[model samples]
Target chain A: MAEPRPAILIVEDEPEIRRFLRTAFGVEGYRVVESATGRRGSIDAGTHKPDLAIVDLALPDVDGIEVIRRIREWSPMPIIVLSARVQERSKIEALDAGANDYVTKPFGIGELLARVRAALRHAVRSPSGTSILRFGNTVVDLEKRTALRDEEEIRLTPIEFRLLAMLAKQLGMVVTHRHLLTVVWGPTHEKDTHYLRIYMKQLRDKLEIDPVRPRHLLTETGVGYRLVLDE
Target chain B: MVSIDKQRKPPAHPFSKIPAIFMGNLQRSWATVLRMNLKRHWVGYAWAVGAAAACTFVGLVMYPRFDLVNVAMVYLLAVVIIALRFSRGPAIAASVLFVAAFDFVFVPPRGTFTVDDIQYLLTFAIMLSVGLIISRLVKSVRRQAAAQAALEIEAETERIRSTLLASISHDLRTPLAVMAGASSSLAESGERLSAAERHALAKSVFDQAQEMSEHVAKVLQMTRLETGAIKVDRDWASLSEIVGAVLARLGERMAAHRVIVELPDDLPLVRVDATLIEQALGNLLENAAKHTPPATVVRVCAQRRGEEVIVTVQDYSAGLSDRDLERVFAKFHRGSVEGAGAGMGLGLAICRAIVRLHGGQTWAERVPGGGTAFRFTLPLEEAPSAPLELASN
Candidate 1:
């Protein structure tokens, strides 16, 4: 039996962007469903039940967030948000509303595809609930709360270990500062994001081949942290 | 001041020697002085009449117990009161009325306008002069106070205007300089550079242009906000959607900081202008990113408290000082964070303006744990029963 090509739903208001996305996805050998308005997108999402959905925050008929919410109400499909450069708050809102990832407009084809791949990969692999995660030469044992580089034990402080564990739990998916802080420190310390940074640096120093330009413990700048299993 | 003085000088033209021009200037100044005096004197006369009547009543009451000189002193007290309350004109009027009232009421033949003793004339003369002197003194003091207030207002306006200009120029120049340098390099040595280097140069030029355009848009948005040109298009909007949009827009730039969003699922939808609230949140996030060190956590959290949704962006950087916290949202007020990049300092101001336009209040405070937190409250009242379709038809 032949495996069916994965389907992707792109909900963008702009025709030119829709065309660009369509062409890009076509080249990547994936079947794409396109909707020019948020209303149509939401309807298409429900009917098609695509493997994944890419939504724009600003839509002409219905908001992209509304589309995300409607789909999220019933579907657990991975959702990637497409937004303009100044729509940070909406991007986070989309993520908190069960979006798997986002790529800003004026984005490179390579970067967009990478995010799409990572999101789809997370969706496919997250179900198995892998206890151990490996990236580059490093192995993170989620069960034992320890990490090793090339089979040699890497020393990590309690805070660093918890940070790594949190990142490991959502391998290849971005974990927000609030999520990391609350999970590691407590709910009261959600705003203590600097603690996450310092510990993240320590974890990267121990686990990454080069802490200066970490491949695994990746930063999403103003957004959050993502642990990439295979850079 | 120099320019004002120069403007006040007679025109350095051959026409200035004309008699008609000279007469015109003279007449204008005279008219101004006369108009001012007329306005002042009307109030002065009213005060004078009131004071005279009061003094006459007091004289009648105290004539039996107090001597003529002591009763005259009461009129002196009236003159002082008038002098302090009114300016030069009223005080002079009070002085004249005091002497006349004193003579008419209690001077010689009680209740008649006669002076029997010549020594009483000395009393009237001395009192009149003293009253006039007090009027002059009080008038000068009043003038000084008014002048001081005007000067302070002018100084504050000038300071803010100058700061705004400085910030605008600096913000505009940095991108312009980058564009110029990068383009010149590309133009001058097109053949010598590798494809990667040339691409980098071109990218720099494009990035600078993008930044300049964004800056210009921000300035325009701020001006529109200040001029009350943007109307609040209140609609029921999802809070999570707004936050998500901002994070998506910030994309790569936000990669340096861990952005923690804590918008609860049960949070009620807020009635607001979606675009404006989105912009306000974006500005706050941008401010946090710029002021805080790279890789620091930026937390954007929202909660429903009472009838408002409080959204806060907290940065784990050195907290703002008391003074900075007070003035951070002021137009063109850049904080003391060294090397904080060339920002026009309009982001926070725009945030404040947008929030205020939505009938919400935006403020910044130091976090209990060592950081700065910027919070804004949007009224959570009037949530539409059905989800609002904010898309334009």
Candidate 2:
């Protein structure tokens, strides 16, 4: 296994949002590097080699989507774009530009961190073989396709299973609400991300240390949900 | 180079302008007519000889019966008439002839060729001077009026353009705001709603709003193109992703009508504005839907030609005329009277500008089998290979 602490890159230009993110990541016992512009943010992404990059689409010189594309050119590092622009076109462009995920602005801090952690975790999982996937007392088996909570097998409906598979595929990466809805349901179901809450509630009630304050099945709120593992 | 040295101007009195210059113009036209001929030709001897003969005859008959003052006045009238009607050469001849005749018959020495007094010489010169001044003033006024008329014409054209822009700018803004506002609100509405109600409402709001928005955008595009505002943002992008995104966003509308897409399995990447290109294609699709009947086949096909790709949207509906094809992309122009009440009427105009902004072309034509076909080109970029190609093979 790797070290306990992970370093993160906060590529947002907004001061308040950056401070909030830095504090959140710092509390989580991770090193946080902050960048204001897309160009500077991208360089920091490379040199610092942080576990994750949280980029905003609107920058003074370069667009965030372009920043994501450039970083994606060399590394398969996880990039989650933060844009105040809610245009569907920008979302697809960011995702297709090699960004791992996207979140619109006026977003919850929990969602941003959730996505940042999710993206980094997913990147780490993609290159290496599967390790024991645990969220609180719950454990998941990727190869055998199984799950257990507190030493008891957990039964999940097909929709719930697919949703878990998609999220687990990313591991800790922040999957877009649009992306998750589409994958769990279909392209036509992309707009119906509310379904995420119901299924997420089901997983949390059955699998988390505290269903009310779930440690593993975290709600990113407005972004999507994130699954964090605790030993 | 003229001097009114008692020899070349009209009489100073305003009354003299009409009698001595204007109405007198008909009788005095001979002098002006002769002067024009002289200025144009090398020899003007015939004109001079002609005026002298006419003056001499009048001087002869009148000189015998009248006294010196009476005959002198009559001869003086002949000199002014000759000066006004003929060249200066002829005028001087008539002046000399009259002076000689006045001295011979009407002076103290009657029938004798002698000028007893020289005061009469001043009279002839002053009369000639007045005639020349009148003719020159008329010509200058004509030139000034012609120049003023030209300035007025140019000013009128500028006024029209500004007026048209003001009305059109206001006209295009309102409906665009309504449509764009509606789409965002509908898309962000309540979630507990049933699928059918949600789908129908979302589709209706989005599709109709999009139609209006596209129309408004096209109208805005037309103005931007005219004002030279469309700038390109060139970058590399996956074609399939742009198409997928457009289709998904436009899905709320295209879903009702069966949208058939055929993109190449091995399509190359393209360099364009992912948003603007999608908007352009979106406008074309909207154009087809608005014009074509519902539940009809609307096919969006992407075909490759070497380093370029042609995206075609064909609708099985009544086709456009040759006249429509010629002016279809023009601002405020319609494909037919069919979709006359359609949004802002700028769909094709915007498409043309967006396509051009990408350094490509867009055009529409009648499909051979029937209906209308809209096509635009995208310069394709060759990627190493698609990830899909590797997986599928």
DockQ of each: 0.02, 0.03
lDDT of 2 at B83: 53
TM per candidate: 0.54, 0.40
lDDT of 1 by residue, B173-236 (tens): 9889999999999999978999999999988887787777778779889888988877775644
Error of 1 at B31 (Å): 16
B1-393 in candidate 2: lDDT tens per residue?
122422576456665445435555786689987677566642434544554565556756766675556655665566556555544555555556555655555565567765556775565455445434433444466668888998898797677566546645555555556556655655676465577766666555544544444444455566676688656655444454455546654655676576777776556557676667777787778777777767998988888887788989889877888898777776556556844445544667777888887777777789888988888888776543322212432
- Candidate 1 Cα errors over 4 Å, as ranges: A1-231, B1-47, B118-128, B219-233, B293-296, B318-333, B340-342, B365-371, B387-393
lDDT of 2 by residue, A40-60 (tens): 988998898877778888888
* Lowest lDDT 10-residue stretch of candidate 1 chain A: A192-201
Misplaced by over 4 Å in model 2 are A1-231, B1-231, B338-341, B380-393
RMSD value for candidate 1: 15.4
